[model samples]
Target: MDVSNAFLHGHLEGQVFYQQPTSFIDSAHPDHLTFRSTLSDASLFVYRQGSTTAYLLLYVDDIILTASTADLLRQLTDRLRAEFALKDLGPLHYFLGIEVVRRADGFFLHQRNYAHELLDRAGMLNCKPAATPVDTEAKLSTTDGTLASDASSYRSIVGALQYLTLTRPELQYHSAGVPPYARLT
Candidate 1:
């Protein structure tokens, strides 16, 4: 469980100005009105108390959190609720096409959905599944006059393969043409 608007809950000092709400535009002080924008994606604020720590993952309006203490998490949740309207999504699930499965042994993260989506986007969804991405016996070369017509698509496939490495660590060696850790063997 995590606080829903944890970023907005912070005490903001100094004067900030923003356009008035569309419905409640004040005619008198419209020039001096303000609103607070959420924190940026690359920045995050964390709080720790004793053995527990709360992480505030801020990506615009969306937030994800993990805390050691349940009571502290609830307290943070209530505080955030009082300050701003928030939607609490209980437990972690799918995020960015990555499926997170929690089990008694450990957690498993997979990008099967993401892989399927990438295949669809690249128009390879209906194509037959190849036995391997690359053949170890054959060396690929661009100098053979096989210029890539769609460089962007090639790049996209490369990016997808890079993402796959997050869970499929073994793919790294194969992508780099290192046969030692190839997925085949």
Candidate 2:
């Protein structure tokens, strides 16, 4: 599911000020709305009422919601719709670069598309997989290569690869050697 115009939903306690956007204003009626900025985990949110529980995972405006029962799921979704301009995407298929496959037993998630995108970004789309990603016996130094010509692009690919860790734990074994905190937030 998704929240439409999520930036407009913030209700602040104190006075907020914003300029009237150029395109929307006539010379006469010049009023504008303001919103508060906030920071959050962008992770999971759990709701519980008696024996019923609902789980909501949030990433920016995108949301993945589930509940203890089908009825609860519908009720929760309806409640959200009332509060916000929520778009019902129906069953989950693809989210956050991960593909969802549903079966009788359970659901499976993978990042094959994300992997391909990463390879393409790194200019390795047609490259074959290496027998080993790195030399087992090789010793590494802090100063290895000079540096990437475009550091931001390098960081972008590394960050995308990091997100893939949700579905590909083995990727954790290989890294860009860039400090984790060094990446753009």
Colliding pairs, model 1? 18-34
Q: What is the C-alpha lDDT of each candidate?
A: 0.63, 0.71
- Candidate 2 is scored at a TM of 0.67
Best by lDDT: 2
Q: Please write out the lDDT profile of model 2 over residues 1-185, one tens digit for every residue.
A: 99998888577899988774434545463532111222343277676667988888878899998889999888788877876899878899989887898989999777777777787989987765554555789988889967889999989987887777645665655455642222211
Per-residue error (Å), model 2, residue 36:
23
Model 1 misplaced regions, further than 4 Å: 1-45, 135-161, 174-185
lDDT of residue 136 for candidate 1:
64
Model 2, runs deviating above 4 Å: 8-42, 136-146, 174-185
Each prediction's TM-score versus the true structure? 0.54, 0.67
After superposing all C-alphas onto the true structure, candidate 1 shows an RMSD in angstroms of 10.6
Model 2: clashing residue pairs?
none
lDDT (C-alpha) at residue 28 in model 2: 64
Index of the highest-TM-score prediction? 2
Model 1 earns a TM-score of 0.54
